[model samples]
Target: MSAATSPPVSPSAVTSAGRLAWLDALRGIGALAVVAEHMLPWFVPSLRPYWFSLGVYGILVFFLVSGYIIPASLERHGDVRAFWISRFFRLYPLYLVVIAVVLALSWWVPVREAVVRDGSAVAAHATMLLDVVGIGGVADTMWTLSYEMVFYLVVTALYLTRGHERSGTWAIVFAVAAVLVGLVASGAVFGGGWPAYVSCAVFVLGLTGVLVGRLRTFSACALGVMAVACLLLSSRVPWLGTAVLAVMFAGTAIYRWERGTGPLWPVAVTGALVVIAPVWAIESGWWWVQADVWLTTILLAAATFAGGMALRGRRLPRILVWFGLISYSLYLVHHPLLRYFVRVSGDLRGEPLAYQLVMTAAALVVIIAVSAVTYRFVEKPMQDLGRRISRRCRGGPQGGGEVRVPGESTGDDRVLRHEERQVPHRVSDDVDQGESVG
Candidate 1:
């Protein structure tokens, strides 16, 4: 195959046409779960107590999918500059659109004027590091982007340090660290003090190290330390943040094992740690009330991820795949849509269950329809534009027949095997192609 159209060498990597259907299916399911999690409880108040935080479950699945794929993308290309470029184009365009929508809505809805004026909103938009910078997400659902950005930085550091091979070990280490950090630094250690400043500074230093490609080992260590600190000290809920990251790395470990780059025992151990971390680290006020549901979320997420792996080669419904294709748009757009729905519908909390269900169905339809349009008009065009620019910079053909990047679009990747030429993970588009970075 030409460079413009080559197969992803490993089963863990995803591409546009060569994507594993099961993963698309998984992402689609997760997207729906997120929507249900946010909107369902609003309409059916009775289900609030019973639901195990569908949003958490959905976003966790997304994070795992990301971890499984992103490092591989960086390694396959071995070009940090290209990786960053790809990420910027794939993520920022849609993000800006969402921010624009939110701003437009602010005319009527009560937005925090202080946040917009105090430079916090600008910082959040520019870096997607709002959570680490001591500001909450501009959008309620956008907080995960902060963690996702940190993950990308951490992976870049690992790739630079040549420590990418020990993904499984790191997963286990992070899981253990989560527990330890929870015990000693349960609350925010750097809410707004020198500790916070130091944390952000070290993070910047680590990113600089990755970019410079000098003292890579030291850079990786610094980034690793910063990642742990951010998770433990900078996050609003340190334990939960740590647990989520542990789960993501566990997914990475499993990907490594599946690709035959690591032994199975490490993945097995990491999986166990992932399962246990939430139980140990989650600071549920009513553990008795929350534990079972939390455990259920963990188990369900694991099962969903495992199911995706098992059915990697199976054919799935096109509609389901379509949902996955639009998953990123759905994730970013649904929040605003939900808010709009509530605004127009007035208080549905006291409405009849049947009426509320109908409204929810209507809302889902609108969300899906808008998401589809965005995926077509916004996502695909920008992805193409990014590829065109990249290909031009690389002095390659710009024609759209088969222009490709490692984890972006590729030729039909029918062969799934252990190749030394592992495919790169495209952090921009998420999982493989057509996946969200969630």
Candidate 2:
């Protein structure tokens, strides 16, 4: 709400285009976390437990972003079918591909004992319902799907109801979460509902933010400071505090960032904190490290959120924006690829350290390559099909839909004008997106 001025990093001159670019760039960072966590787990065990935790943030970011965008999407569409179909197209095809790949890999590695010991867990993951209980099977990375799906169902249902009342949408979302709590508490699904519930809470907070509009006198610097504090505070007991503060602080960041309401210091300082936080964790001892990681992650998430807010009407490289576009497929597919490497290599010690490193890079490269192909051949086609079908069903916007990117809301089912459109045939043979590791 700071008079809608642009952020420091320049990019496209379109309204909200920066949001897409910056958010995707942020997601690219999250995907790297997933890729690195798996590739190096053999090298670092302590960080292993936190892999799913960090990877899960990518999903939470996406889901909450979706909630913020849903209302805007509803406003733009022909009707709800377009909305639902669009979502189905966006999610299902890529998911189906991942599931198939997982099955194929699991068969190859049946190493039968692990599967026998954890077949049920594997089954839950394959079905994407593993979140019903707190147990994550072999591929722990997919745990966020439960919340993503739940958030999608709630938001889609709201859209389908043809009720755009912000309060009403949130009421329904919370009610669904409450029912989920009841179900989980009774052990009906025997799946813990914490992640899903926490995500749901975040989604609701996002929805509230959209409806409430920008905060008054909300200096971006203040937002950044508050975000860092809340982030560190939440780390003390992540399941509760971290999740809650993530919603609150990150929520503020998104609002101000989207409105372009804050100053450069917020983004600059936030980015600096992100860079230093990991070192803080390492140098300050285990306790600080734990809290600092969460703090760093959220602050970076916020910073990129701001990046997305600014990318519009500014000038930045096309490569950065492109990465944001393909981020989804990269995220969904990376873990299975990582596990495949683990299963195939048998022992990391035998190969020269250089060779092991090569093996890791090879695995990531293959996943990215395949994911890029999937994006062009599978995902894009399904999206086009959805658009054509939506047009047939409701005949408005001619398949124009919207979705939420990490930091900001892009409109709905069909992508909005400001949001980057998915070209059915475009492939950046090089994927030259800028580095996200900072």
Candidate 3:
């Protein structure tokens, strides 16, 4: 039942030219796959494939997409404050709305047992670090946000340290850790409600420092360390957590390789290690983690991503691009809506096959419609506000120019030009977008 999704790219990074439309296509594919994964069981049990998990496939695609674009978005702006601002606005509005909807409907659909059991849902949701801190998300899909937040913190710290470009190395390191840790470790080492509280405090203070520009490096480092520590010692599954980071970093490594800033070996090595990370995992009992299924899912996700990259220069279907525009809202809202639908309608599993298909189609239409509305109303306006605020901050006296990392040089101009050429094809709204599980 464990599944996750990625967040959308910052508004500032998006452009009217629809650059990165391939990514939007990928996000569209991932989003629908995840929704179908969640929906098939309820609507058409017979159609739910057991060979390879659609949810995992979607999540891996999202993680790869996130890995590839998040660092690029941050680097493209070269302003930590702007990056954080954009991310916050892009992700939080819809996220909070989902949480609120879930809570409001709790009378009809009880809160997830895990959330009620943990008693730290407030702290966990507030920090969006639910899984790593041993708390369930208010909505089932929220678990992925924990890892997304971790990646952001780690990337921010690396940016400050001028080590952000060493993506390939980090990918290798984490991939190795996944295999090593899966052999022995499973579940949180720091068990309790306390990690959530402490981490939340640190998260707030660290982010405050980062925004205020006082002790920014120290604060970012602290947040990064806390993020890694939580992933290693406090996650529900240490190896899987590590593996997720490896996948994301692998995405970053791929981005580096494409930009000519790094080599390709790490990408291959990371992919191999991740493919095998869960094969021998002592803690993994899920059917999807079985060697054959896991490998197929991994390879399929890799292929899907490669296909998107290969098609990056072409004009993606407008329907897919539109789906990408509302991906985040769809990802966040669909789960709760599904739960509510099930609660109200009761089990439809015993319905006739045709009836089930009809109901499923109806549900999808509703979900997509609602998602689009939220995207237009909530996500879009908030993102626009974030972009304006970022621009204003950058225009202020204290607003600075692009940050120059220690190892970068004039050669970056060529890379920037290369990126600019590619930017027009990218999906402006959905850049660095994450997917969610069913």
lDDT tens per residue, model 3, 334-399? 888888777767799998998888888888998999998998889889887877787676566755
lDDT for position 133 in model 2: 36
Model 2, range 193-233, lDDT digits (tens) per residue? Answer: 34334433443443333223233112222322332232222
lDDT comparing candidate 1 with the true structure: 0.66
TM-score of each: 0.81, 0.58, 0.90
TM-score of 3: 0.90
Candidate 3 residue 166 Cα shift, in angstroms, is 0.8
Off by over 4 Å in 3: 1-19, 117-119, 279-284, 400-402, 406-426, 429-438
Count of backbone clashes, every candidate in sequence: 3, 27, 18
From the highest lDDT down, the ranking of the candidates is: 3, 1, 2
- lDDT over C-alpha atoms for residue 241 of model 3: 88
> Candidate 2 — which residues are off by over 4 angstroms?
1-19, 43-60, 111-127, 133-139, 157-290, 349-353, 396-438
| Candidate 1 Cα deviation (angstroms), residue 92 | 1.0
lDDT of each: 0.66, 0.43, 0.79
